[model samples]
Target: MAPVNEAARPALKAGTRDAHERRIDRAVALIERAIAQGEEPPELGRLAEAAAFSPFHFHRVYRAMTGETTGQTVARLRLLQGLRLLASERRSVTDAALAVGYQTPQAFTRALRQSLGTAPSELRAEPERLWREIDRLAQPPQPEQGEDAPPLRVEVVSIDPFQVVALRVEGGYEAKHAGYERLFGWAGAHGLLDRLQGLYGVAVDDRRDVAEPQCRFDCMLALGEGVDPTGLPGLRLTRLGGGRYARIRHVGAFDGLEAATDALLARWLPASGERLGDALLYHDYLDDPDQVPQALLRTDVYLPLQC
Candidate 1:
């Protein structure tokens, strides 16, 4: 066989990189979709098969590409989903525990505290503080800088009442795409796709305040006029009572939304003299993640304010 041409080596290497990234992305998406659909965590062999890698080498490959073991990924995803359920107040700790694949509530609590440094009860009571603590612990120490950061720009705007058909997802916010996939499928099947006026996320639990398992995010499709959700079996129809809101536009990855929200609730709200309203915080997804790059994704976070 002829030796590989030196000039073509970079192209070959780039092709290999692309193939590896595609495989990793496929594996990650499979894991996330299964979790979102409330399915048991896929076995390692199953994941390996899905990624078209040998079972023996898949674990190492996954870890090398993602910087975490497969078990670690499953555990993190499960724990985050469990926390979302817990925060929703709709499920008992025991229920949330089982729903997220824990054998019992005690086991879930132990893992929660060990991994997140907060108990389920503590998360319910002091969600914001505990969430902040988790975020702090997850990051490396930062250097103190002079106060020259740009101010968080917020606008007080009145929104009209609207209704949405939402699918409740009991997982970390990152798993929400699965819920959207289901919602879109349902709409497409019923020929209601054209009636989807906007895409919204109802944060049942403030992600910045709650543990991942205790957070509840609803993947919502804003309904156009005259659409009733009476026959939707698995979905909920929620009417958002339109009112004044403090809105902050977050630009960049979804991961940064938590910090933006913290800035809003901690700094902006107090300074703006706005009291929290009797409604949940929600998000308007301005750009579709599938179409936009992570750094360019836009989300408008809205905190309801009293009239």
Candidate 2:
């Protein structure tokens, strides 16, 4: 990846930057709670209060940070959850439509097709096939000598095959931790939490490649032999593709991701000869920054290589 020439971008003052981040985090929490409840969303004023910002500014900043209005964010979340239900429960298209608060089936299908790029029927069929494969691999013995580790570059290396009990997430990256929370909650409910030994935040879309902020990511719980991926509620088992990358590990909250990513693109990539690959530069969380000390976040980032 070549260094991104950001000579024209403005720099933020330190104090103002911190204040902005704190405000953004508060706003994100309010919206996430509303989605998890899955009922009538809170009023705009109430949400503004929760974020400690005036309603007018709240609406503007919330959209600025998350790339969608509060209302749009909640609506998209319901639709993603509805799609999951459709794939896993094999619910009638009509029922799935209504479950997500859609008034009519036609409306739901139309939106689903636009977002997913496939008809409901075709989408449903793919899950069925994935489920079957996951079920079949239900206790394969680990290779005695596991191989496939490649030179630690910032490039995507072909990863060895593995199964995961995953929850599909569709939204901007800013709201994704909520999806991870729900996924972890589901794992706990099913006694699968212990099985997430090698957790992965599987990003299907690279933000660097697309201008739109509306993209989906799959927050996957790495599965061992005991976890069955078949017929699980909104669960999926997938094989991740690998290639080249530019990797880094940053300590602290995901809030600094944009800055860290920018640094990698502007400072590091140019220093090295590697070019960003077609795949998104990947970030692997090695330690829970919340639990670990400030200096010990084992987050490894990978940027794809070109030459």
Candidate 3:
């Protein structure tokens, strides 16, 4: 994969997304940098302040983007630091542990074992395996599906500019049904209902990072030519500046969306000559979950690509 180009056009188009998306991306990048430098991940309160989110909400947002709780991500990063110290710097076992904030060498070894299924001593003899172990353990298990699941199809396509009437709700990952319920209710009460052109959703945060109540999700519907959402309760006008997107289809139930997204970034994007950046992640819902069975619902995941 080519290196990330900070000045890419996709990064420029990212300005079209809600500002909060950019803030969250910045906060995550900060935490990632801290960990890479062998420093402690910032405290929740401090991170929240930096991200311009409340402590309670930022935790959930962090999980949504990284697919791991803050503590889990930090632990993994620290262990990685320990591996670098031991292998690359040739630090002693005890010193290496201390370098990454572990109180004792034994504690570090235990964590390494738990996370990688390999003890420190074993890895010391074969240091190259540390990264391999990290990759193996990070992969989420793919959901089981029979031949009924649609074959994965991918395309690089340009999206046209469009506007959405959306509402942000905080809840657990699978519980987003209630948010959409509220959105539809408000839309109906305002007599703004129309023949659906396209159903849409923006994942504002991840559930795995916090309590279900704290996870933030955005659900929206495309604005029809004559539809006006002005003064509508709980609905805000969001404009997505369309650009080239690497659109991939998820053909199974919603439960597998996280894993599918993970696979797209970790397994495919790198080799596809693309780099992930500040561009807003958007979800295009093609089928209504209410009308269609869970197994048949289709959602397209879009990641902005540099033109």
Cα RMSD, each candidate: 22.1, 22.5, 9.7
Q: How many residue pairs clash in each candidate?
A: 11, 24, 2
For each candidate in turn, the TM-score is 0.51, 0.39, 0.59
* Model 3 Cα lDDT, one tens digit per residue, 73-171: 667667766777777655798988887788788999899878677788888777568667656544422323323554445566667667777878777
Candidate 1 wrong stretches, greater than 4 Å: 1-148, 206-214, 230-232
Q: Which stretches of candidate 3 lie over 4 Å from their true place?
A: 1-38, 42-73, 77-99, 102-152, 173-175, 225-233, 276-278
Candidate 1 C-alpha lDDT tens digits along 1-307: 0111111111232245456557766887777777766677788788888877666446544654454566667777777777777767788899888886787899899998898777888887987865655454333222121125468777777777788888888778556888898888888888899777889887665443357776778899986656666555668787664777778899999887766665665445544545556676788888988899999999988777677
lDDT of each: 0.70, 0.56, 0.66
Per-residue C-alpha lDDT of model 2 across residues 280-300, encoded as one tens digit per residue = 344566776558875655665
What TM-score does candidate 3 get on C-alpha atoms? 0.59
The TM-score leader among the candidates is 3
Is candidate 1 or 3 superior in lDDT?
1
User: What's the distance in Å from true for residue 20, model 2?
Assistant: 32
